[model samples]
Target chain A: MVPQEHPLEQLLRSDRMPHIWCPGCGLGTDLGCYLRALSGMDLDKVAFVSGIGCSGRAAGYVAVDSFHVTHGRGIPFAIGLKVANPELTVTVWGGDGDIFAIGGNHFIHAARRNIELNVICINNAIYGMTGGQVAPSTPLRAKTTTTPYGNYEHPFNFSYMAAASGATYVARWTTAHTKELTKSMREALEWKGFSFIEVISMCPTTFGRRNGFADGLEMLKDMKARSEVKNFPDLEDTDIGEKIVVGKFVEKEKRSYLEEVKQWR
Target chain B: MSMKSWQNQRGFLFLKEERCKGCGFCIDLCPKKVLRQSEVMNAKGYHPPELYDVEGCIMCDICTEICPDFAIYRYRSKERGKNA
Candidate 1:
């Protein structure tokens, strides 16, 4: 008989098992992929940071050096950590609202500056941790706690924003695409400049009940059905929709912020 | 390949019952019909998965990758099959 321990025990704070995430939420799936991608790397060199949200709990679950920082400050804090010790492979994991709304400026600037960091944004459509408020990335006209009548604001196309902001590497995949997500995450980590990966996760407890999705598995199956893989797809055509375009939209070589800064010195 | 042939080189499944939140990802996504939700519930009153057909498991690790909770995994067994 094989040892009964979970394979990921070494990478998890096992005492904290049975996490606070809802039963059908996608955060755990995304975190599993993230951990799989980090395999074979020196654990000491990886620095994980997360902002306040349901997805932010990923940092606490991970066994690596992680920071569960203030709301919307994950990117800036990660950038500081990278600058202080460029040797450390820094990554920021946050929800869509935390990344594209409150930390919007920091995200664009970090990408524009070509910071060496991997950003994983879990896009579950609503502000789940805050009880399903209409988030900046929530689909237009979606019902939420705050948007009882429906939301009027348009959501950000995460991959397009990252590509436009000058991120050297960008990709988007749903939580169901575990293998592809893992591969993309590995590539993002390997890339020397700014990298962003948007994972469309399902928030069944808060976001799903309000939306058409009856449960998480249904949402996951729907997400899988909607996804059309198009490697190096046109950024404009990669918006989330009935038939979502999922793939790596951008990959280019660029001098990192540290590299450029060092050249001036 | 036949079922016996596949069974010869199968994986040993492991479950963390206490940690499972009964998401059903592993049971639903298992390529082989080897995992099922337990009739008995955990301390949290949720049904976790149990190995239903150990021989049918292929060690794909899809369950491990797809589980929202870190509740299930298929550990590689040392016994190698004579007929590959």
Candidate 2:
């Protein structure tokens, strides 16, 4: 007898199963949420873009018109896609290192210009793909390969940064908050202007081991315990540290870059 | 709440054992506490989650939602099965 296909099989490239993501890594959960968010939508018009990193591989796994771009270039590539065909739903998925480190300039500019694209920043706090190195989103005093002593650098509060930089939609959630993350993705997809969703993910093999978590499940439990959901909290108070503020921090109507370009045309 | 528990409820939970990485996300987040890691190891050497008690399962699908590996899923029967 033929086995039944998984409900999410259609959205995923089944041949790519046994994905490269390490066991207990939160990328799979984030990817699942994203796929679920797009499941009932017009997938034909959806485009997934990613940059070099563990999260970059997401583009290949998703059964959509996808682009696996260069390191730190996912946002620009997605922006170009949006500009070329304003009808398509363009989303840039990448790790915090790819999105906030090398491609940070593009990230800020796109948000400042209010580009019509969805940006899913999977923040595992370390450069998971290139070995566990320090990342822009790495918390203070966290141990990484580069930060053997401890990460002294202050991490970027992505939710606050996006809001301050002019993103019309800004939100943050941990992988443990599956239902909320999926719902936030759906809402971000519907939003017209630049939308940013920072999903704090687990890198069990690398970050978790280095940071003292027993495994991925322990890391998730820590996230679940530390995260406090507050809708529209003050931007200044949203900094990453001991307690992570996770929720829809900002959502407001704004004319997208494409809308302004159309007006100019 | 007690009255709702009195009705004969039926639900099904399936685990694609090979696909699971034994992350424990499902067991941790399962609202009904119906899942627990089994002693048996799969091909990957991870103890995949097993259904422990089905009595309080509301078919919430929390396990499916929290599972990173897409290894577990659940469904509820339209008609309640005969009470054991």
How accurate locally, in lDDT, is each candidate?
0.87, 0.86
Fnat of candidate 1: 0.87
Cα lDDT for residue A214, candidate 1:
84
How well does each candidate superpose onto the true structure, as a TM-score? 0.94, 0.92
Q: What does each candidate score in C-alpha RMSD?
A: 4.0, 5.0
Residue B12, candidate 1: alpha-carbon lDDT: 61
Query: Per-residue lDDT tens digits of candidate 1, residues A156-204?
Result: 8988999999999999999999999999999998889999999998999
lDDT of 2 at A154: 88
Error of 1 at A108 (Å): 0.4
Q: Residue B79 in candidate 1 has what lDDT?
A: 43
Clashing pairs in 1: none
After TM-score superposition, the amount by which residue A62's alpha carbon in candidate 2 deviates from its true location, in angstroms, is: 1.2
